[model samples]
Target: MSVSVGIYSVPLVCEAVPQIGCGCLAKPVLARLEVHPDIAEAWLHHRGDVIAIKWLRELGVDQQVGLLRAALGGDGDSQVALVAAASSSPLLATFPNPSYWYQRETVDQLSQEEAHTIAARLVQRLSQARVPLPDGTALQCDLACALQEVLVVDEAMPIEARLARLLGVARDTFQQHLGSQALSQLDAWLTPAALLPEDAG
Candidate 1:
């Protein structure tokens, strides 16, 4: 039988890539991430995004933030090792709703290309708020910090207690600048929803 690896196992396929600084991961390829606890919780809090759901379900990692953290390579592991170590969280049941991305109303009304365009625009608008970072040698510090909030917890801080502390930092920092409005918007937009299965037709 042929093995069916989910999107999490695949590389990101982006036609137009962003400018990445030195410390950032090389190439915009899609890879599994070790998401921090809070980050996972944060992802769960959002309404929709099937891609994230499919990855989580297929990986069986439970915590999305931990996935992001692992992807960040906070540990000294080589790139290959890091990818191999990503947790595999499986889907236990059908998602509560069809993937927000492919909802019948939107998909039926819009062509695939148009749907993607709309989604991208919405994501851009929703994430407009700036996420601040502590000054340091790392380039794209603000973006990195924001990315870290969504990144999975690093292996360096594998234990729950340490992970919790890291989460505390994220919540406190975001809370201060974002306050209620920013947090509300993030909750509305970035939360992962269900994605249509690859074979769905």
Candidate 2:
């Protein structure tokens, strides 16, 4: 069963996504975040796109945002981790009008695309100069910050190499999973004449 619909209007500082919406908070993606102690219970619906979170204690907006950001990935500059929560749900959530990125895929579909998703998402972020969250929060999203949000490289690694590392798989698997366009985009980004030459290339 899904979270109770009536509770969605309780208004615990809803951070509705500004534009079309974001997959960052999508149930299948961000919903996989760790549910901290602050969250008493969570329910996921609409393919994990929309979530309802019951707080253990009352928290302010900043606290909620900070906690969610921390869970999404605050270990470094940008990397959101894939965590397994000991709860009925996998995401850090809260009550709202019941909406987020609606990807509309089943659990099997999500798993099928899970591999290389982090890397691909990082690559995808390259296109957006600004990253928006569920509550219309916009953060300056530069290449380095974007990489920091997802990929972790202890040693030196180029953009492609780092992305590959984030993929956590062989080249064949990455190609098979993400396909040619993502790779081609990476290649294009790496070119000397690529856009944002001053930034990560």
Per residue, candidate 2 scores C-alpha lDDT tens digits across 1-201 of: 222211221111111212222222333223433246566554434343233445666666456545555543442323212233434233334333244322223222232233233334444454452422222112222332333333322233343554444333322333444456556544434432221213332
The count of backbone overlaps in candidate 2 is 13
Top lDDT model = 2
> Candidate 1, residues 1-201: lDDT per residue as tens digits?
222223122221111111111111211112232132222211110111112323323334434434543554443222222123234333213322233222212222122332233234333443454433233222223323543443232223332443344334434444555565556645443322211112323
Error of 2 at 147 (Å): 20
| Per-candidate clashes, comma-separated | 38, 13
Residue 106 displacement (Å), model 1: 42
User: Candidate 2: where is the Cα deviation over 4 Å?
Assistant: 1-35, 41-52, 74-111, 114-162, 165-201
lDDT of 1: 0.29
